[model samples]
Target: MGRHSLPDAYAAQDSGDAPPRRRRTVAIATMLVLAVAAGTAAAAQSGLLTFSEPCDDSAVRLTMAASPDIAPAARAVADQARENEVKSDGHCLYVEVVARDSYKVADSLARGDKDPDYEVWLPDSDLWLDRAKGNGDGVPVAPGDSVASSPVALATVPSASRTLGWPGKTYSWAELVATVMRSDEVRLGAADPSRSATGLLALASIGASSDRQGGDSDTRVAEAAKVLAQRMSDGDAHVLETLALDSSGAEAGNPRRNHAVLLSEQAAFAHNADSAGSGKLDLFYPKDGTPLLNYPYALINEPELTTTESRAALRFMTLLRNEDSRRVLAQRGFRTADGTAGTSVIASAGGRKPQPYDASAAAPPSPAALQETLGMWTITVQSARLTTVVDASGSMATLVPGRGQSRMDVTKASLIQALTQFTPNDEIGLWEFATTLDGAKDYRELMPTRRLGDPAKNGGSHREELAAAFAALQPVPNGATGLYDTTLAAYEESLATYVKGKFNALVILTDGSNQDPRSISRSGLIARLEELADPERPVPIIAIAVGPDADREEVAAMAEVTGGGGYQVSDPAEIQAVILQAIMTAGQGGQAAAE
Candidate 1:
């Protein structure tokens, strides 16, 4: 474990910028605490950091949840503020900062099971602060008062750098990722985006890049990007970790090596700091754009906060913005709150020498767009092991007033385009339904669930088979919609064949209501759906209804219970956008857009 593993709360409580001698002592003391945590003798009362109730007689207490990586710098600043004995309106103050995983804290805040006990939450990125608010129903998340910032970049070993180009060559984020994805020489690794901004930003860049392209190129790049993102979903800081790791444990000349880790610039600084003398990992500043990990000092403003505590919190925030505080943070590899590469980062005792820098950091996408991107990433990049059920009824052949193609033709093109938004490894099958289209069966499997390639299964890959089947699909002229029964049957089959480690969902593209007399009633369908519903084992139904004649209400109801979504499109051409939104919205536990 790096020096950051020890809880900053204890070591930094009163150590106000320790001198060289005291710093070593503090380091040893922290090591002892860590050792005790791992020690067999301390098994009964493990070395977990816990808070003792602060006595209320003399002061106001400011508790903070600091991101684990930067917790040390935060602690140092807090310790100095502590020494100052910051007073607000004659009240003395106490500041306490504990290392907490940003995702876990955000998750807890979203669950509403616990109120954030801290007067402030210092996540490494604003993304967590945004996520913690949970669609704005709960407490409004106060914006981050950024105390520090870092840009998401790639960190690679020297050997990989030789192949991918070094500090002199500038590659756009798209060009850079495509190079890594197309080859097996060096595997690109990313932090699980749910836990850290590093991986999230990488995947978002890929999605945005693909979104900019036209036609089949968009689909091809997106599918490939998703595969890369999934392959690189290592836990937080895996990128930095990979820089030092080797299976052979060989240092520089070994064949065994990790290629690249999409990470924050600060992380690269930290890793290079850790390995000062040898094997320095290099940073890659993307040419196109990058998302910054702005370490916002977001105040926890609750109605329950005491007036004195609020004042004290403001005072604490002011202290953090001071030169001394900024200096402490900058020395530890973070950019100053304003985001400049001050000499402090290079001049600090263990800091790595500064590398070539680029200033074209991209502005964050709109809040809705960011959420959609995140939702898209969570669903499509992680991917669904889905079985698509398309309506093959006579109504699907109805031609529109303006659009040139039949509903089925537009629907086929849309489905094909949507497939580009998924990983090639994601298992998918095609099924078409209408009453008695295949003798007594309302639905018939056109392609069995398999991986993308035909050879992935005994006969053919799901991707090739489904694409061919969809292209050849013709609406049965005499067929009646089999909405309810087909959904129930499909849901059951999907549930039974659910693959582990895959986001499971059923994509239903329909044009009309259940007109089959033999089909189950809406009430019966809902009851069966209720029986199958499980948040623990979710298989959402992403239903898209085209044209005004489609039964959207009933289709939406089925989606609602199964933790999916129902969408209505005036044009079959709009099916692409609706399906995209449906899948993205459904991926995030179906947090639908506000109606």
Candidate 2:
């Protein structure tokens, strides 16, 4: 943690910059009461800093949800506060920021179930303040410096995208949005509104755009939700929480696989900078509007509060605003309050620059316009049909050196780990392929997309049962390859049986090329696949190749043809990574433009 100087809300309040006098009077009363008691007043006036509440010596706990855009800033602030506290002979403030998705956090606040002792609350949008208003005992959140005056905007990867840019200067919002809607390749990413500020902003932007065209924001939000629902079905997008950027990227919360994501500008900037050498991501700013993620420092005010913690919070605030801390924030791709850096950092950090952040601008969609837009909003998410096609062929028996394990063993282990990623709402089934299916048959009879909790369900179980199944997996003896037949069987079974489900996807993990003599030729297979997909209702097929023997070209073709993707992984360690990516990307609403 690096210590830096930040503006104090107390000071701002004292300087008459706070809300109305009535609110200021309440704040003053609260401060006086907090400073009154014997030991408390002595500690406050004496400048002795210590926590009023019990905190582990190793950690300064905080409750913050969905502030990826400000993590670096928050970190620097915490570090600098600890250092400043030490100089004043105070205990170290071990900052523990609880990262949740914007939607969950907002809901927690709405339900009044979130922790209330936090010294700071960094929200992705002020919408949360409205949600949290009547639920907490804290001072009213009637708009502050932390809330953005204008809504944030949507963004895209600049290199591959042809839309975006200002109207007249480039293309109008109508033209840009129309372009995106028509192209399957022009995939878009936004945070889940329920979990991320960026997601909320994206929703607001959609509403605003629709309203501009004579629709309602709420309806637009719902309509955009439908687009998301479809994308999720198609394996093109993932709805992960805000802070999963580094740990999981776009695959954080997705039950299926996805490659693109929606994050706060700050998070995106930080991620791009962290991946500067990789050059794999780009940012696109929707000209309409985006969620304004505003970070505000808060403190618990119950009678249990202590003077030490309050001072510590103030000290932390100072560190977050210090010049060095500001620099750290700039390095992570955000503009600081002190005007310390340029907005170009988004691109410099490896992502494309988005629309400028105008601190004083109005919220997206004027209040009067929001209603019309709400009517046009769209949101739809349905139960999906998912299948896991595993290769149990003898070739999987080969051992990889560095992993110190056979490829088959590793693949099974990875599959087991990936299973934990699924939620109860997801429909799952499994199939093992080799020269023959179980019971000496060419294709085994495994359950298809059954509910996870039923007794008859082999697909759903506690970790113990899942682990047992994984441990028992092994290639069958004296079997010839029937890869093609098995794939066809799985796909046909899902399409025929799970027709009622809104989305269907087949995940195939293979270590070699198609070897079944009965399997159709590559071109022939492509045509048949097209005919089966029924352009009106496409089913995505994600293929993961395991080793050098895997057919990269065939795998890519399968994904491209089926509106999904084929990812190659020579090492077992890459299985989890590749599978997660494919599920998120392919499961989302729109597919990549035919490439």
Candidate 3:
């Protein structure tokens, strides 16, 4: 009845309930504790469970690492399949389901740092599938069939939703999020983008939301980044748990209480159910569409799995696709792949409404955007080491007649605006260059590269030092450009002190060609760059040539040698646009990709 009742699933499928332990704020920590305990218990029971007789090696033993939200339903399905004697090549199939965080599973598979030890992974969304494959070329990750799916939504109580003028007024995804972001009246909660799909997808939406034309306009992704940096919790589940635990240190019905969270529709439903079916936790679907958790089933068919184990994993996958499993999954609050409603058997899964199964409902981001956005949230929050070199030649003083400002002034303002894009955890230093400024060296390190919060050589935070140095930057009187010498020094210094994990690079902004007559030739510099550049420790040079007279060709050539890029802007006012583009491409090697 359920299968035929509805037949439309645009995105993916879901499993069972949101784990009870995860209902509290300590969900991530608690899951870790459980994983350690579960792993230990599993190891102790491993020997007898894998083999039939004392010498039996005929059985196929596989570990199934399911996402926490869907693990219980998957486990139930596995148990029933095992009981029904699911077989692969005449061998008994053993599937041991362990609930692991999707982010942990994805990162491990991506880096290959540790053995994931599982034949298959069932993360909440298909986003991880792209991420795992992105880790490396040799990664043998392949997508499989998803059993259940759910889409993310803005979760809030009725009073809070009403207070924000929800029911009477329809809101677009951008409007809803912008309201949450700009208004102090509504307290918003979200999981860390680094570790949660809901959080990652939410940020991606916020990032892409402003790419289009708008009304009552909110700040673009730049503003969204600042808002998210300040508002996000340790993790997604943690934020939800906090709201449930202390209500943000306010009484439950208080007007000033924390109001909303970006969560899955199923999660909001389950939370409402736990609240005695009060429908206190309401789901607000953004009319513009939302990101769905497609339940990507990734099969691990690499050096880790034997031929028999791989076959068994596939067989179990086929078994999970059967009608009975769908029924069981449906009762656990998930729709079947074809968009069937949950059964009445689930008393606490809250109301069942048909979910849209289309791109508009669950817009999957491209692989590049996903990685860049995460990098924006993490590597930048806990980001790279960069050295910014500015050309202070007399030519920089030339006024751009249109904007009624000097090129140097416009460039400085652009640089300062770009500075807001990075967090204090990122390390950056400043340097200025002109002929004969450093006694024939042509460049002087105004600030040493260090974490933005570190006490710099000149005192104050590294950020403070850099800002002050940039502000005090004056065009050297009668100064000539010294591009070649400064670039080589900056490159060598960046290489010598490259931070091991973070993206390490140099940013060069200039308005003219190298003018130091005694500096290294273009030929020699190219040779040295080719000889020293290592793909393993990439230090790209993000170069920008301002004005029509700048050596665009030479700038692009230098950037290419170091696996970076160059941008040329004839107008000084567009320097801000170039700065934003440079920030995105700084250590990204031109295009943003998985690191």
Candidate 4:
């Protein structure tokens, strides 16, 4: 979803900077009018005098969970409201602004098992809202207007900035990242994409820029992710700690310290404001476009909120949009809600005129694109152990409608393309299934799951062996689909061989439903999977139904039992993307469960 706006009726009234005398006169006149109206209504309603009661006895208390980076500004606004006696419907607004990590809050909301203990959530980006409402199963969160904005950029120490030609020369996101990665002197670091919006947005921008440049963009993006993982931090605050302690880049040679980091403009501003001469950072806003961190104000479980609490929360949001509140935020290095920053803010953030920091913000990446990038990042950071089971039924030989290749041929090609996305450390194995493929069994393992970097009996690496195996896949003549039995067998094997700390999964691809009458029924297979599933050691099945004939609902039901999901792809060529997407989704689910 894009940006959200307040309705006309609830929009904040901009009380401009009026002189003290003018404000006093206006307040007096308003009070006189209110007093007359109250006198007229007092005869009918005795509670009209309650508006004059002390705030301590008549206050609407609200707890707000705000992102740590902007918590200070938010807290300041809340404090000002309390000190100034800001009121919502004659009730003093008392907000408790608690600094909280966005990812943690998102996870808690996603679980939906307990109350969030807060009326509102202010995250660094709207992306977290998607995570909170995953699959429409998490606690409901309604997106409101953004309170502040920050652009994602690369920040470096003085020495690194000079070496990279920061002010004098500009580079596209992909080119800049490639330059830093190739350099032996400068080490690039970032907050983990799965946890940091700045990291994820910057990575997405790089991917988009790479795609614009064409040719092997996926490989380039995957390689960049690998490099970034080497120097990754847990979150935005921690990532800043990874930067060099000194401005000269000498301390960065320690290997643990980074010469440059992917960070937000506001973060850079904060860092610069706290640092002295050498500790200051210079920013590089990618020439392509910078992604913005729009801190969206969201209501948590709005329907459950009492009317008073809801009105108070909206009043707080409206106050946050006021001119005075905007000034408070801008003083703390934040941009306005629309991303307009003053010259001083940009300069303090180490941004110059030539850096293109003022360019229109990049179009927000779609949820699917973000999901795929995150999935790619997850696999890149944590190696995967996958057992791929492909259908070799007679129907696989059917020709694809506009393509000359058979269904099997296109699937193999797609699978091979997917292989290139995995690192050498990842473990992958191959299996082909059909009716009685292996003497009384419906599945036969062509290769045991092993690291791609490991050597094979034939002398080359396991990767080469897997590639050959993938190329050799063909439809079994007159064979029928043996989906149910094969899925259970592969899942059992995968779980039994689960490697701790790795993304272990069973990937099954089929073009049709089970046809073997003697095989285990769908319900039996699902029941067995549910019994074998372990929460502590999750092995989610990424089941893909290929073509129109495949039973999507059947596979979805079976997959859901083991905390996995089933997806359908009308074209075999779509398998690679779906596999990564499923892996990302399954990985996130596993993380939530563990939490």
Candidate 5:
């Protein structure tokens, strides 16, 4: 027989071999030893044999940093695991869950300058994982299974719900948002997209849904974003605080209180559970479909983790996925990873049949699309203060390979188009550079940075004056690129006139390398920028190499010194998108640094 099989002659030996009491005791002892031996053998076979007693020694401790909204549920599961003495490879698991903002954690991870305090990270959305692993230079984080999910939706007080005809009447995300914006009585609020995954996802969904409706969708989305920005909160939890205190929505008249807010389904459920009667919020699941906030389980700096710690982290993730743990999550207003919830969970979150709550989730936006949306939102909300410097070297007159327009013409048109994206509150200036264009100087200021809404000396808005200047820009007859000196001049001026509480930057567009032998050297320019760059008043230089002739590596190295980045475009038309993308990247980096 196998080693696990008992001997057949043991029963025969026990048949009156000793006194009854002694036989009983001996038999009991023998059975106990055999059982333990069998257990030990089984454990050894599974590669989990441990010499220490369970929970007495060899405990595997781990720290988990979870998004604030889902931290409580994760902590509950962790608590239960400790109480039950859950084991990983025969070692007790002791997990500590800490609530941290997903954005902050992502920023820290993206920097990757130091070791993280937590071994595990549970962000509210997988979107944050992409942010944390920015450009593949950040700390190595391996994403595991999603633990829970929540759909993004609009939440409203009773009066506002009645106004929007929630539950009984449904609208697409675009329609719902448009209706909310058009209404004078209803005020909308949201978490800042730059800092909230829920906000960014909802915004992206609105943009996508609006595209389906056609007819100037970009303008419509921008207008909606502006409205939401008026009452924007710092983050998800803070956005809830912006809601009207009165369930009747009478406080809608108060500028500080909002009648509606973009929120997660789980957040609505938690709010409703704590509220009574009409005080509870009613949710609207946009007809186009809602984006889900998938709470992804991630292992931070996995390579740096010990073998036991790594196994324990995964084991805890398994525990979180177990049925009991899922039930605990549901009780706290979270849905399953697949976005399904029980009837009670749905009802608590203000969902009902025919509201499209059961509809399939909207496809996740591409990383590029999400980045663009965030870039747009960042510039819009912060009100940029930019000094745009254009290279007027003769090379800018080169004709495009396909389009009939010259490179200079295309660059101008693209810049003008980009200008439309900025709000009236944004400050903009213009400058042009070439060899000896301004007597002793290689660069000349065309316009001083001022609010687009501010009046110009020409008796029109600064916006119009700037537009005219952009249009009139012409390549000097035989000018050489004075990139290094022009860049240093622009950076110094931008730093000197730094506007507090704005997205300040110096935007430089060039078509070639620095050709003015009299100008500063690239190394000198970089050293000067590094010395002048102030964290207290950040003004990154967004340098774009506009054509094949421009040295991308040269520009990139210089730009990096000022906490900004560099980009190259084969076609001048691509400059518009690149500018916004650069701003988004720089803004996020600056924000992270400040934090």
Candidate 6:
């Protein structure tokens, strides 16, 4: 998990600035050829690089959108490449292992806007590969070891073993899954396929395993996704990732955030079987062993490169897989990629050996049977309402690295990008919180409103207003950090008072730590939010913490209470986009529940 901390300021400090123009010197024709080229190439006479594969030998710029979760491993690979442990052409191997969410990775590849110097892209799952192929440019290759893997079995803490079925018998993969689903307490946990690799793979596994009635497996998968989403639509709900369903709730921060992403056997080790713990996490392996996702390593051949840069990247990736690195990973509750490393509890208890993991053995569900008999399905569940909340506090004056722009400037640019995702039927409102109008008290008010009249009808032109607001935003610094207070205010005063009938939401963006506990205590916040929402009629609130020590737990609680989730960004530049997406997604979920 990414440490929820904001970075320091940089060169510029302008609050509202237009998005910086990205200058790519590559010829358009060259990019087209690269897009259309195969993933192999014959021997190169220049001897710069040669591939027996059919990919074109031209400078293929492969951009693997590395999730923050797996950056350590990706950087480790880069380190190995630098030390010659893993070899590749520096000139042609342009790998941009970015910290982009899975959806963004798919979008960039699908649109052909992403030019990777490397041909291979290792996402969390192979679903995006299918979508990419549908767009004509199939995934070129899947390489590298599993970055993270865990047993997808029934898991209970050592403390709860007596209560839960810890030493349960080895049921078949289908039987175990079916059995789990049978229990009200045994809900499945996985990331949403649209946004997460684990989610997509899990959906694909369900589709590939089961038989579809009238619709294709894709349709079935979509339906199952909806069921999973519904189960997770409430604050108290927890989907089993790897831990037991009971292991997650509003009280357990990490578990609650990762309620839906458990590991499959394929990720555990070099081989596969069904051991005791492994049985709990039965593998719903694809018919073709789940199309492998290629994880590529690129050695930057940039003119600005330094010896340290190369060393750092290579050392980091190698470290990720090294025994020490594995230990670090396990300490953070992440599964070790190397099977031999086994499992270790996040916090050791009196020097006891950490939990043991048998990566070699797994209980894979019958691929053919799964293909023949699909169980549940999922859907996009997109249609909903969204509200964007901005923090114009004094701290917003800080700057972010790389872009040499202020946090506020980058926020505006990112918000503008987010505006592009809304539909007319999606009602949107904005609010800002700080000290006071005349420096007396903390307050929040509706800045603007955009009525997305009807999805069945034409959408209004509120995107421009949202974008303008983002651009016009200034650092309205003042008395206190009223994020929680103002959020409550929005739910009570704004949404309840003005936006009466429609679904309501708040995407609160803040860079500073929580200063007003009275406004947002864990218990009080959840209780207050509960009062605003009915069990059947739920609303969502997404909180984004941008600065160091931004009180992620409090924000997460707010999200959890409102049937949504929380996101923390270390980089201020990513705040606008991330927060907006959170708002939009929460709104969508809220609208679905209301309906």
| Highest TM-score scorer | 3
Across 336-437, the per-residue lDDT of candidate 1 in tens digits comes to 655565654533212232333546466665556566556665665664677889999998888876887889988888888767665567778899999988
C-alpha-based local distance difference test score of model 3 = 0.67
Quantify all predictions' global Cα lDDT against the true fold: 0.68, 0.51, 0.67, 0.84, 0.83, 0.45
Deviation (Å) of 265 in candidate 3? 1.7
Lowest-scoring 10 consecutive residues by lDDT in candidate 1? 20-29
Which digits, one per residue and each the tens of the lDDT, describe model 6 over residues 526-586? 7888777654555666778876747787678777776777888887666545644454345
Q: Model 2: per-residue lDDT, tens digit, 1-595?
A: 2212222332432242222111111121134234255645444433354665543453444443335456545666565655565322235566656554444444555565544545455554545555565446433332223311112333444332333332222222343444555555454445444344455455556545655777333333443455554433211123322122222345334434333444445555544555533233444445443444445444433234454454455544445544565566666666543222364764553333333443333343433232222222211234445677777788878898787889889987887776654544556677778764555445664444564444443454534344455567677666555666676667777667644434567888888887667656777777767778755555678888889889878877866777878888888767765665565455443421121
TM-scores for all predictions:
0.63, 0.47, 0.73, 0.67, 0.65, 0.36
**Candidate 5 clashing pairs?**
none
Clashes of each: 3, 87, 9, 0, 0, 61
In angstroms, the error of model 3 at 591 is 9.6
Point out the worst 10-residue segment of candidate 2 by lDDT: 20-29
lDDT of 5: 0.83
- List the lowest-lDDT window of 10 residues for candidate 6: 3-12
Model 4: lDDT of residue 168 = 80
Quote the lDDT for 274 in model 3.
Answer: 64
lDDT of 4 by residue, 253-347 (tens): 68789989999999999999999898999999998888889888888887777766765777788788788888899998998877788999999
Candidate 1 Cα lDDT to native: 0.68
In model 5, state the lDDT of residue 407. Answer: 90
Ranking by lDDT: 4, 5, 1, 3, 2, 6
